[model samples]
Target chain A: MTPLLECRSVTKRFGGLAAVDDVSCVVEEGSVTAVIGPNGAGKTTFFNCVSSIYPATSGEVRFEGVDVTRLAPHVVTRLGIARTFQNIRLFRGMSALENVITARHCRTKAGVVASLLRLPSQRREEAESEAIARELLAFVGVAKWADSAAGSLPYGDQRRLEIARALATEPSLLLLDEPAAGMNPRESQDLVELIRRISKRGLTVLLIEHHMKVVMGISTHIVVLDHGVKIADGTPEAVRNDSKVIEAYLGKEDVT
Target chain B: MRDRIVRLLVATLAAFLLALPVASLRGNSSTGFTIVWTPAFVTAAMVLVGGAILFAAVEAQRRGTAFWDARAATDSAVGRRRPCAAQAWTLGVLVATVAALPLLGLPGAWTKLLLETMVFATIAVGLQITIGMAGLLVLGHAAFWAVGAYTFGLLTVHQGWNFWIAFPAAGVAAALTGLVIGLPALRLRGDYLAVVTLGFGEAVRWVIKNEQDVTGGDANLPGNIVPGSFRKPMGALGEWLWQPAAVDGRTFEPGTVQALIDRECYWFALVLLVVCVACVHLLAKSRVGRALFALREDETAAKCMGIDTTRVKLVAFMASALWAGLAGVVPAVHRGSINPEMFDFNTSVLFVAMVVLGGLGSITGSIVGAALLWMLPALLANWFPEVQEYRYLFFGALMAAMMVVRPEGLFGGARRKGAA
Candidate 1:
């Protein structure tokens, strides 16, 4: 079967620096794929290009064989790609539930006039959105904090809230940038289970992970990058033992 | 229960103490305090009472006192029945009280001032949609007001159009101007947006000032903007609607007719204000409204949620302009005059102050803010004429005091915590 999301030799540049340089990857349907590299490896920048937060400088991105390189970030979201930032960006003033509900914007359509009139359809959609938002929060284990401001949430809860918000978009593919960044070991362990559970739900998850244990344990496929170049791609075990992957992580040192 | 009584006594005593000096200062006789109903004294008393009640309520909750248990029990009971049933009931009572004000037999001037307050309330509420909810700081809001007022004034005077015909045209003209201004300004955020809007306001003022042939420039526009269609009081319906009800015995004097018109205009403005409030309340709770909040919070995140940030911002600008535009009809129809000086930068700043004072993102806050600001000035003029000369100085001090006391505004939304 065709991969759910494919990046075709994508390149992103800023001035003289190439943030993402001639990188390519394929995320299989219903698989947890990990992109791992050192700092400035362009993992987050690659995610940005795929999510259309920044348009790719060259080449294309395809979702189920459709070119989406030129689409706006919102349009990309509508086309079933939703992502969280490397740093959490929840609506600070809004409640966690509202943060999730806001992500359901494309899925729900109640314009100003219908809302003003309080049309039956609009009310129904609102109720449904609220219910879904609550459910998503619960799935992320932050349901009890639903009414609390997202900004005021504990760091772990805020990260999970961002995930819940992304999930509210009901995407076919979810991009999580550093899903385990700054997380404690226990939290990272819980996140591994969450990613596994998400994959079991038949949604493709492409995550950037720093924790080697997380990338090795849960991700079915691992893509390794170094200096904005994709150096290794295969099953987790295959990518781990590759000489280049080891070389990228450590120094070359004329490895045999 | 014991704590509640003590709290109530404390509040009452504080109110009395606060009101005493104010009442005594305004007393006609300096030697001995005599009960007098000067505007400033009455205002002082009201403010003190309100402050006392708020303080008591807050303190009671902090102390875990039984002072609120009774009210909370009743509130929960009401809340269980329907989500906003208590609010609906409170609103009904408030409307009934306002409607009964004329029955208390206030002087015509006071009634006229109250009508003017309603007009400003409408404008402040309109401005709230942009600055309060959408998080767009607008210094050019008065330009939209000018568009509405001048459009109505010009149509009724020069074009000989009726108020009924000109009213909607004024709103449309202002909305269009909002759209035009928003298209460019929305591209810039925060301070840059403010600068663009400030320029836009000045541009509108300059156009009216220089285009003397049409606008009448420094001189005011001609009179008779309110339609005469109801002047004869329709046959039966008109007479029933506006009977020119006997006020102080004799009717038909110029002052009497103006007073009667003031009463009629008060009702008109009240109805419009109610409609505007309802519309604002509805819009603020809608999906579009949430989108605006999302846009305000984080534009990039909002866009990632599939919200067209630019579109939402533009709609907020137009919606805000529409409210202010519609409100402009009152001043035009009431005064039958239009001039560039009326829609100055100070007027824009005052409306902004009103929105901030009322509580940003709170509809009721905007109304209360507008009413307090407008009413306080009038009352000061009545009881302390000399202070009126230093009106801006007094307003600046009041604004500073309000900021220190309640930066979120008197009715700021729970979500607007930590908001500047």
Candidate 2:
């Protein structure tokens, strides 16, 4: 099958710095892809360029066979792409249900007037959205906190909640930026399972993380970046064993 | 709540005295100011005292130290959508009072102080969108209000446009202006944003003041924007209200503008108020709203979430400007005029203060702040005309002191500090 998402020679520059330089990768359907790199390796920036959060200094991003390099984030989201932040970004004052339901906005059919009038159809959609949101929150294991304020949820649940929110968009391609950051060992292990379950739901997951263990544990394929350049791409074992990957991570002396 | 109740009783007693018409209907200055404390006020006072004693007794008997439970931290597995009861009550009463104040309108008092409050409340809600939701410090938000007013004023006066047509146009004009303001804001932040907005607001006011041909400057344009439908018939409600006088001209009659102005402004403001509330509420519950909150909480994190922070910022800027514009159109019709001086820096400052006083990103708080700030001056002046002239000074001072003590106003919530 054709890849669900592809990045061809994506490059981004901030002044003299080539943050994401000459990076290329494909996210296939029904696959869990991981992008791992050390700090300042432009892993996140590469994702941003692909998702059109940043206008690439060069290259193109194709989602579902359309060049989405110039598309806005919301537009990208509309084109079956959803994302979660490395650092949790939820509508802090909102309830967990609201957090999830917000993502459902992409799928909502109500016009501005219909929503304003609180029409019966719109109300029905709102109720249905809430129901779906509850289920999604449960799917991510934070159903108990569905009505809880998003900002007040526990850190690990916050991560789960973010994933649930992204899933709310019903996107085919989910971009998770550092989903494992700040997670405990147990939480990280749970996240691996969560990723597995999420992939089984037919979502093409593309994750950016610095966690080596989690990266290797769940990814079907792995891609490594060094200063925005793709250094290696293969199965987790192959990429993990790549000498370039080791050098990209551990400094030269430690890389023997 | 008890403490607030006691405060309310004290305020009520003061309100009753002030609502009494000074100089009397007879215009006899010699009769002096008679203190007419309505019986309803007596009930309120009783509630106040009873509430205070009951609250004290209850707290004394309770095991806990405070009335409220400590809010859960992010590390806590349990998350609860703890509604702030204080805010709920404030909003409930504020809405109820604003809705009812139109009864005073049927009496032909131009700019029913209550109506004015509702109008400003609308403006404050718009201002709240910027300062509260997007965390944009708009020092000159009133300029948007001016833009709305002028748009409506010029169109209705020159083209004889309908109020409904002009209203939306005014709002669009302000929104476009807001988008323009957002451009400079790309290079500004925090205090710098405040300065720029202030400059922009002052510039708008100056433009209006300087463009004497259009705005009429200090002379102010005479704006009498009548709804084309007003002549279309009021149906049962209109007929009932306009019923010919009974006893004499002194008897209650509804046909006069003085009688209808308060009610009209109240309804017009109420509709817009609901629209503003719903918009803010929906925005807070959408991806767009989330982006705004994220921007406010941490722009870096929002960008990392694949949100273009600049785009979200601009969207909020336009939304806020649009609201101010909607609010501005009302007063022109309400006052039957649009004055350049009305859209000044002081008005902008007042808008920012409302959002700050209400908690930032808290829609309910914004509404409460708008209503409270809007009504206080009128209520005070009605109850105590002697102190009315210095009302703003007191309000400004009170707002400052409140910010110093409780930077959050009466109903401030945990702003952008939500489920994340």
Candidate 3:
């Protein structure tokens, strides 16, 4: 079968600097793929290109065999790819439940007239969206903060809320950027368990993380990048033991 | 305890001093400055000072907390609860009272004022969609209002279309204008969008002012476009139910007919206000509203949630402009005239001020804001002509004070903690 997501020599440039340069990778269906890199490794930039937040300056991105390189960010999302930011970007003023319910935008269809009229169909869709949002919030373990403002939630809860919001879009491919960045070990462990649970539900996850425990703990496959170039791709155990991956993380061995 | 007493006394004294209108700056060079305390000023000062002292004493005895602190607490509490039956009842009672006003022998001038207030209220509520909900700062909203009025004026007066036909057409015209402007303007965000909208507003007004023959330019619309007494149509409708033969022979006096027409117009405006408010309230609670709120909060996040930000923003713009257009028809039909000057930048600012003062995104707040900002000035002018000279100054001071005291607005719910 074709890979769930394939990037064929994708590149993104800002001015003269190539942030993500000619990097190609594949995310297999139902695999928990972790993209690991040191700081300035262009992991986030690659994610942006794939999600169409910043369209790649060169090459292509295909989801399930269809090219989506030129699609708008929203269209990319609608086509079953949802992502969380490196920094939490919830609808700050909205309630947690509202944040998740808002992600139901693509799944539901109700226009101005139907809304204004309070038609039965609109009401049914609204009820369904709310129910699904609540369920997602519970699944992420932040159900208690459903009515609290998303911005006011505790840090760990906010991360979980963002994950819930992404999941509310009902995406087949989930992109989690630095999900464990600010998390404590206990929280990151819980996130690993959550990822396992998510993958068990048959959804593929493509995460960019620096936390070795998280990347090695839950990811089935790992892709390593350093200075915008991919150096290793394989099962997590193989990538972890690779000499180049070791060199990229701990600097090159001196040839004295 | 002594310090508190001293503070209270000093506050009362300051209130008295501020209320005293003793100083004046004359425009003429010969008589530059003068201090004259008229008896009216003295009485006004005394009454104001007494009221302030009484209020302070009562407040000190009752809650002991600052007024605004208590108010904020209650506002948050109310905001948390979902809209319940009690709110619907309150709305019902308020509507009933307003509907009963003209029939209970409300004066003609007051009826007209209430009618005008309803028009502004509708516009302010509509504006909430863009500025309050979608977070689009459209400074040129009055351009849509102008489009609605002109469309109705041109169609009814020039083309001889029926009032009913022209009215809906006016709304459609404004919505089309909204779509045209939104297509380009929505691409720009925040302050840039605001400037573009402001320019669009001025451009529309200038077009109306310059297109002399078509719009009558600086002059008002051609022909007496105002409907001659809403009475005839109302009376004909009443006749269908219960018309007394004895009353028919009398051919009701012109004054009585005019009063009836005024009452009918007032009811019509009231109904429109109710419909607009209900529609907006419903829209705010719906899925589209969620998308709008999401868009307002964060465009990138909203897009990641699969929301088409551009399309949602356009929906908000068109919805708001549609209401403004519908509201634009009321004055043209009831007052019987349309002028480009009527829909100028000042009117747009006033509508925006009403929305802000009432609290962004608050439906009832919009109506209250419109009534306070629109009616208060007119009422003050009638009751205290001397204060009329300082109307704009008073308005500016009130707005500044409101910002300092309650930046979220009187009815605005407390925003999330740390939100900019």
Candidate 4:
């Protein structure tokens, strides 16, 4: 099968330094992939380029083999790719359930007129969206926080809420940027298992992580970048043994 | 359990307000300044009682007092609290009391007062779009009103155009002017936009003043709305309009022009009021409305969310300008003259005050706020002329007290249920 997402010869520059320099990679269908690099490694910038959150400097991004490099984030979302931010950008004032339910706008077909008229179709869609929001929040294991303000949740729960919101978009591909960051070791372990479960559900997943263990253990394929250049790509075992991959990890293969 | 006390406080306040005109019977009507003390009693009673209750509520919650039972700090109680039956009852009672306005006092001026309230409400709705939903400060709403008045004045006086077409034409003209103002909004934020719009309002006034040939400068536009319309009172315009209108030879001196204008405007204002309210209701729930709220929350995030911020901003600007345009025509028909002096800095400020005092982002609040501010001055003049000159002083004092006490207008926002 064709890859679910592909970036070819992608390059991003900020005046002098290339944040993502002519890198190319394909996220295979129904697989969990991780992009890992230390600080200033361009992984997040690469993610932004593919996610359409920022315009790519050059190159093409294909979502399920359709070119989508120039689409706006919401349009890109309509093409079945969604993402969670590193710092957890939940709608701060809205409730946990509302944060996820808003993503249902991507799927809603009922117009404002229909909603105002209280049409049966609009009512049905609203009911369905609410149900899905609740179920997704539960899937992320933060269902108890559904009625609370999203901002009022603990940091760990907030991260889970971000994942819940991303999943509510019903994307064919899901991207998580540092979802495990700042979590304690136990929370990180739980996150790894959750990623495994999400992958098993046949949702193609791409993750950007700084933590070595989560990236190395769960990712079906691993890609590494150093100073905007793609230095390594292959199976976790193959990428781990590459000398440049070792160098990109600051020569700490034992830990990586 | 404690709902009854709040209900009782509201009732007592209404009773005092109804009795205010009796106390004002002692004062003469000509002067521009005086404090109507009977209404002052109502304001003071509200302040003292409301302040005490708020203090008690806050203190009780702090000490975990048993009397203030079940007051959870959980936001469900305050932020997203549903409007209950008590709320519905309060609205019903208020409407009924206002319905009795002419019966108790001000018998002849009931329609006039109601029509004026509705006009301000329309202007306030325009402010709600620009300031409440879009989070843009518009201290210059009167500019749009002026734009409408001039459009109607120029068209009707010079071309002898009927109001049916000129009213909507004026609306579109104001919207275009709003679009011009909206261009600079692309670069400004918060108080900066407010100042620029304020300047724009002054510019509109200046243009009207200098163009005496067109605008008649400071002179009122002689509102020559065809006379036979109200005098007949048999057609569609007078259907639901209160009978025995101001010029229906009820109590007015026979054939007085003021009574004629007043009578005709009663019918015209009623029609416009219904249209204005309905139009605002529709606009509030439209696609543009959703986009406006989203932009207000975070412009960058809204853009990232795939909403076109520029398009939404332009819509809000037009929405505001159009309503003010519609409202501007009311004064022309009411007074029969559109003067450049009518659209000044102070009128714009009053419109802003109506929106803020009502509730930013709330249609109901805007209506109530508009009515309160608009009527405060008039009520002082008619009911208590002794307090007429000092009416604004009382208004200022009341507004300040409200800001401290409730801060969220009389009704707060038009509720958006299930919105997170």
Give candidates' CA RMSD values in order. Answer: 6.2, 7.3, 8.1, 7.2
Which pairs clash inside model 1?
B233-B238
Whole-model alpha-carbon lDDT for candidate 2: 0.68
- Could you give candidate 2's per-residue lDDT for residues B1-420 as a string of tens digits? 764454345334433432333212111112322334444433434443444334323432342323331111111111222224543354455455435433422223323544565566667766655676567788888899899988877876667666667778999999999999998797678999988888999999998888887667777674223333332122322222111122232443345533454466667778788778757666554446655655665564454344566776887888888988988877776655668888788778777777766556555456445656665665556558899999878987877776664454544543433323
TM-score of chain B of each: 0.76, 0.71, 0.76, 0.71
Judged by DockQ cut-offs, the docking class of candidate 4 is acceptable
What part of the reference interface contacts, as a 0 to 1 fraction, does candidate 4 reproduce? 0.10
Predicted model with the maximum DockQ: 1
**B-chain TM-score, candidate 4:** 0.71
Decreasing lDDT order of the candidates? 3, 1, 4, 2
TM per candidate: 0.85, 0.75, 0.86, 0.74
Clashes of 2: 17
Sliding window of 10 residues with minimal summed lDDT for model 3 chain B: B21-30
Clashing pairs in 4: B32-B389, B33-B389, B34-B387, B34-B389, B34-B390, B35-B387, B36-B387, B221-B337, B221-B338, B223-B336
Q: Give native contacts recovered, as a fraction, per prediction.
A: 0.64, 0.20, 0.71, 0.10
Error of 3 at B102 (Å): 1.0
lDDT of 3 at A65: 95
Query: What lDDT is obtained when candidate 1 is compared to the true structure?
Result: 0.76
lDDT of 1 by residue, B171-237 (tens): 9999999999999897798899888999999999999998888877777764223332333321232
Sort by DockQ, best first: what order? 1, 3, 4, 2
> Candidate 4, TM-score vs. the true structure?
0.74
